[model samples]
Target: MYDNEYFVVDLGNCTTTGEIINNLSLALETLNHTGKSIVLKLNDNYLNQSQLLSIQSLITSYGCSLDTIETTNPETIAIVENMNIFVQKPIEKRVADKYDTQEEINSFQPFSMPKAEEKKDIIALKDVNNLHFEADLDALKRQQESIDISSDLKEAGINPKEDFHTIDYQVSSQYTRPQEVLNEADNFSKSDTAVFVQQNMSKAATMELEKEFENAEKNSIGVYKKAYDENNFQEDSWEEVDFYETATTSPVISDSKSTTYVNQTLRSGQILESEGNVVIIGDCHPGSEIRAIGDITVWGVLSGIAHAGMSGNTNAKIRALKMNAVQLRIGSCYSRRPDGTNIPYILRSSIFTPEEARVVDGEIMLFKINQN
Candidate 1:
């Protein structure tokens, strides 16, 4: 069988060196022998050093090495031994030993021409301990089912024991203490003592008063009134504005440019620029940069600098599964991560809250996309 890592070439039927050379050359030319080690089974064929050297060179030219040679001929064995190649008995001999009759041996085909359909015969190692464990468990289950505990208990009940015996027991009187101990107990009861009660209700009442005082302080500082006025004006407004709505319309009008897809991760110092929209399937590491004229999207983490709308389209947005970029740019506006918000790296997680960033009122603003 031709294993995935090794190939076998059987040339036992070829009687002459020229026939062997032709068969081997044809086999190598017809099949894919790249990066595979070749096992040559010569059987009774005899070849000298120069012929063997030519075969080795031919195998080498096809990017394959001659790993082992199987032959019963002494001359062929000697040639292979001198060339430092491993030698083994022909596979036919091994098969003959297994099967007694020549007809049976001829009928048995252990190997064939390397083809896609022959992959089913390729040997593979597997662990069978799980199978044995399951069998043992099944045997134990059968053993447990064979026993009938209820029936055995009933049989024991039917045959009662007659060795039982009963004995009478006397009750003892209560023990009494000495007269000096009684007098000490009476004196201890007559002593004066102080009692303390927990004031949990008072603490709760104090907390309520503190909360009221805080409300009063806020009212005196006029902060509550200012917030109330703001809310009241918003409620009375003719047109209600959504919190996520931009104050000004986006500058980008069309998205007719072709999109660019990047499948590999962009490491530090790497830069990717596209005239149209850009989509990255992997992470953009620190110090890397991505510039797109339309929009930018990252399926993975974006930790580098991302400039969307590089051609000054404010409507172009930068979206990422994890948005922790050092700097985000949209159109002519750019914003760095806020102070104290810098992190060396973000831990990978299956859960993600994808976010999108775009220029809003001359400032970059980010919004979380609802997965629902």
Candidate 2:
């Protein structure tokens, strides 16, 4: 407030005690003032007695004038008045002369009051901008996310930087010993291939599995065979043997005709020639031929040629579960449907039945199943 005789310091909005100390210190060092009065213009900030004592000491040591302190707030004015510092009024003298005596000023002790000491961690603005002391939470999270697990492993000594040969300690010695590997190789080297396979591949289990598969296949075939026997009762008389065996066997006696049983199906282009009766447990498909000196009985469908009683016994009969023959011969006599050609569409309905064919009055004739 004094014109040009005093140096003025306006600590504009210096909110913190640290900021007030810094501004006041800057003013004391920078300003050109000898014994001239110096004024501190605090807008509304209040300084505690401890801070005021420090400021008073700095002013006294610096030999600067700190007689009149200006503040707008009544609370600040009360604090400055207690400090024994000069307070200027408009067109009037200082208020310290009227309010406080020299003895009271000499006895002023800011330390005598019971006040809590506030500690301020003060850092220069330049130092704050230059140093990275605190970590940003979001930046730290991003950095952690970018860190590689391999690098962490490296830090944990899981994957050492040294070469394998250079490493003296045995980290993997527990997992595998050299003596154990040599013993394993020595034990297996003398064994044959079969022994090696049996020991290493667990071939016993594999063989057991194969036997189980074979048994399952046999059981499935037995089930199908049981079903075939139940439906075609005449197949019980037939033996499950190769068809070629029937053709290659020795010729039977002229008086006694030997019965030959074939269990498998006769496909097209196959021929079964027997010296006596021919019993087929399975189907005789189209284009197959069966020639027997005696009766010919088929347990399944007979869709091919059948020649029975080739030695001229017209009484020999041919029976089947389904008989769709292309031609039926009994004692050298041939019989067929009304149509000359064996068209499956017509023959299926006429001949395909559980019927029998025989020589009736010297003519090959199809007849209904005769139980007698």
Candidate 3:
């Protein structure tokens, strides 16, 4: 018998960090209905420092406080204490030298701080290799040229780690192995995470290059080639593929069409996003949400947030079989479910009938669909 205000989250045998994050997302969504804080009642589950910190950050962003934490285990108690210390004031403060008393300093005189040590440069040695060259002087000249290039790039704020550090050797001639060039593409830095190959490569080479880019956290891979014999390269010749989603996908579209249909009810924390119009055949729970580019048509009770014209379609509208939405948005206009006292008589009577929300005079207003 908990209070009516607070949203209670029961952590039942869910010890993993992933489970905690998923559950907390749902709990946060549900808390939107009551505008109350969240309470996690731990049942044989413990959260580590990282998990607690993530939870604290999530709730803070939601504009809702983590009200209470109930746990019985001693391990859980220690974790909670760490969370309190993390959230409390005075995270880090510098004290003045004179803040401490002379007597106190004298008592701890033997534990005086050590002097700041001077930093020493470290030199690494590499294995020597003998290679056939035109002349020893030529090798030395190439080494000097590489050094000059590296220094120039560093002065220009272009980190050479992506180029020089990753490359086994520079391709000085056309006879240089393509495999070596492919290998050098693996080296990625914070600034430059991509490699450009001007030479024409085969499909196999392109596939290998894309694989390397995927490992280097690069999304866009550009392969430039001449489109015609005249050397006029159009934008079509510059082939580019977005590798971000193929390696690791973001939120995906469940259905794609002018009118997308959802057969099942949306649970807490479940988000339904559509490129075109959306039609939900089931109820939208309190924590659920639906965002459509065109219109939103709900055949069941709609208690969640519904956004129509998400892609800037100003003529879009939201229609629900039972008009009990927490909030409705049509284009730039939005309206929340009015309180009992504020709800109009016509709107109240059509709660069971079909009700639509549309933008009227730059504001979202509710209207009932006529049966005649």
Candidate 4:
């Protein structure tokens, strides 16, 4: 514990001011006696940014590297558009070096939506405010409950239970680059320390390492995908299916299911086919075709081609009173009877039937339209 003087210490009962002072004193004393130091730690989980930086300033006495720790939580949206780089920069250092003017950095994004609660992320790097209560989770919950739930939050699909608190976590300073440490390995052997860190690791180096690791992982995944894609083209256990030209979706031996066909004038050059009973109320115009695997009917004039029972069922029949239709069918076989009939032109309808048409005594016959 003495060697790990710069540990990420968790004061479990630091909610009281007295407890905060006691733990802070103990931690500082431990580090001072051991010839080690604690500089910075960051926690972004359960405390606001202002609260975190304030606590850091309250404890820090000697100005040191890794001394200032800042934190943030996952907000639903960013305050300013793509301002992450701003957060990484030092608070007091050159703003004019980065932006054209101080106004540019200070001025809020006017086009952006107003924040429901302004997050003041001010930190105290200079003096200490006698550490009042360190943290009160119950007080935090009560504060959260006091805020009225926004209608916009409801539209954003967040329930009342969802809340975020930004807190600070501490980290050690003796940062080093592995390459620099390797170069001084002989010197390290001369020294008594277990690990020899030659040079301080920069922030840019940490960012670069993170980026390279992501790239390597992504490339490995791409190589695996390419290998699978090359082999996936030729699938094993492939099967081929054969379908009829018109009845592509129907089975080889199909029966008519319960179905209905509505007001479509099956005009010339058009054909209607179904797997179930077909009903047509309009004219089946001449040269047009109507075929049903089960049964077919025409309420209006059937002055054209009509075929019933398409699936080789001779028991199915076609009956029309006008009988001027050029083609008819029961099952697989078609009937192409000419206009030369026993009845005259005007009486052709009477000769056939008034209404119902069906296959009777092995041939198509007609009865009244409503008789069936």
Candidate 5:
């Protein structure tokens, strides 16, 4: 049995290129050579996920049974897909030209800017086959004459009102009720049915006739001349329907290496360093800081500070004896209190304990990491 003495191994300020140590398993083997189970005392606070996984893997590889792998604040990185949709109003249906000076019209007068393929609006209608003209035959001729009018008025180069002879026909078609046809089978269901004397005819033949009658009575979208909600009408032919879930998938962390803290403040101008877990023993002076890519714990007073989880580890935490730090964070998130107002308590006080920083409304909360 060993005496009541603790052997401290200060992991010298080492430069870790990426998330995982180059030879993590070998590093763990060296730690286990002491014949002591791995008790990672993170001198530098600020533990990121990649380093956490690396350290855990190292200890396990060395078969150094975790005597007490104390990790505070199980950092949680979350990417909630918020669906705030921008709804666009459907296009409106413009008024169609259908009214005639005398004759009835059916459809809209679709305008086109004389495509090379199609014939121009210039009509040979006047010289066409013999036909009976409408009652207002003079007006009909005048309307046709309007399309062939001089290019000046057509291009808005000159207003027709300035011309004496121009009648200025502002004629437009008015919508009319469609001609309704009465069906002979309107009351076919209530009408008398004659019994068939033919023996060769099967019951199946008789049933088919009845089924057709039932279908005609049932209402449908096609049965109506217009859509149910014409004001908000959208042509089904132009619209499409398909699954959009694939386009709205969650993000995947491609490389864990990119998940380490980049911007960091080292203790003094000496450049603070870390391997995995970093612990702060005293209150850090303003402008004087410490940064690491692992867990951060302050056993003493913590003052001027820019605490953060520069890496993308949402599970990383900031725990202190007093947590009124100026800045706090885990991963890309930044948790901070106002200047002068945040008085971080870092003493071995009754209220302060070694715990992981938890989240209370997205902001970091300093509390016992495992009181739960």
Candidate 6:
């Protein structure tokens, strides 16, 4: 909880340094911590000197000062002593002490169960009936007597005074015979030869439908090519549209190029560059940049700028589970998200369409790696 004067960050639930930093950063970003003092609460969670300094720096960045630290870890206390920050017992310990004091005070007080007279009064209240409820019941009886039951029965085609056994029930003649019996009789009347012919006709019809489906699948490739040609036409010939024609020399694809793997989320203002290839195991947020000489592959969403084939290796490509990059560059070619495209700053979705972007001829083209 935070107030105008102080903001308390409870890192006691976090078990790792990364979790602590991530939680602290999120709290700073989402809360109004400006010009206030901060109190960090930790429970038996160790923090080294560098980690404490980073936390201090992070607090200062939000225009807040680290005033006090409530921690149960001795290591954390030692680190805070040199940092000139006040230390105190954790909130959990303080709350436990308060409860203990209250219990001790309660022990000396006089208390007893309810007396017999008070118990009798409580039991008598449960047996008390409401006079208004009895009046409502009498009113309901008067209303029920006013309703004309004979008229309702006559309207429903029943004589109110007639015995139930004496009443006549007229049934439709068509439904006199049970439907199942009629069906069984009809099936028995059909000849065996006729039944065989009917089954053969149904089998032939099913086979014909299966053949049609097979034919449709075989011609799917031609249909896709026709649709592609109709929508991807340019004013100039496809061969003449060389956007990156200046790069005439091709760089050799080294067999031993090292690959770098990053396992943390790349926040804004973070830049990751690799000489060969770069693989990110997490999301690349907006305002971050990634440059690789060989290839770039993101296991998560790529919502930032990414440049592959920085040294003119046009063969290099960029791939991601969700391809929503702000700008994409491959070799000498540069491309950006189309104008008026609605790209969210942060994408959280259960469904992901893996896509790959590569230089096709002289233009960057995206291709779906899997069909839904």
Off by over 4 Å in 4: 1-255, 319-322, 341-353, 360-362, 367-372
Q: Arrange candidates by lDDT, highest first: which order?
A: 6, 1, 2, 3, 4, 5
Which candidate leads the pack in lDDT?
Answer: 6
The TM-score that candidate 3 achieves is 0.29
**Cα lDDT of all candidates, in order?**
0.61, 0.56, 0.53, 0.41, 0.36, 0.62
How good is model 4 by TM-score? Answer: 0.27
Candidate 5 residue lDDT tens string, 1-372: 222121222232333524224443545545443443433323223455455555556655655432322222222111000111111111122321233321221121211122323322223333331122222334545775687656757597765545423222211223221222112223223212111101112222233445455556321111000112222223642345334853686764332122222222233333233334455444455545444445666654344453334334456666665454545555444554432343322221323324456544444554444332
Name model 1 segments beyond 4 Å from true: 1-254, 344-346, 370-372
TM-score of each: 0.32, 0.29, 0.29, 0.27, 0.25, 0.32
Q: Whole-model lDDT for model 6 versus the true structure?
A: 0.62
lDDT of 1 at 280: 80
What lDDT tens digits, residue by residue, belong to model 4 across residues 302-360? 76666665545556645443445665555533344422322333332222223444554
lDDT of 2 by residue, 61-152 (tens): 77775766766554555566656665432212363344255344333221111112221122223344322312232454578479767766
Among all windows of 10 consecutive residues in model 6, the one with the lowest summed lDDT is 219-228
Q: For residues 212-272, could you state the per-residue lDDT of candidate 1 as single tens digits?
A: 5554632111000001122234355545554466546565455334677676678887788
lDDT per residue for candidate 6 within 1-372, as digits (tens), equals: 232255667788999999999999898899765877777878889998999999999999988888778786755765676676766655445543553442342232111222334433433433343233345446755885798688788889998666222122221222132334333433533333233223433343344445455556321100000111212334334656555873785765655256776766787777787666787767788878887767889877788889887656677888887777878887766676643343443223333557788776555767654211
Please estimate how well model 5 matches the true structure, expressed as its whole-model Cα lDDT.
0.36
Question: How does candidate 2 score on lDDT?
Answer: 0.56
In model 5, the runs with Cα more than 4 Å from the true position are 1-271, 306-308, 338-340, 344-355
Task: Identify the superior model by lDDT, candidate 5 or candidate 6.
Answer: 6
**How does model 3 fare in lDDT?**
0.53
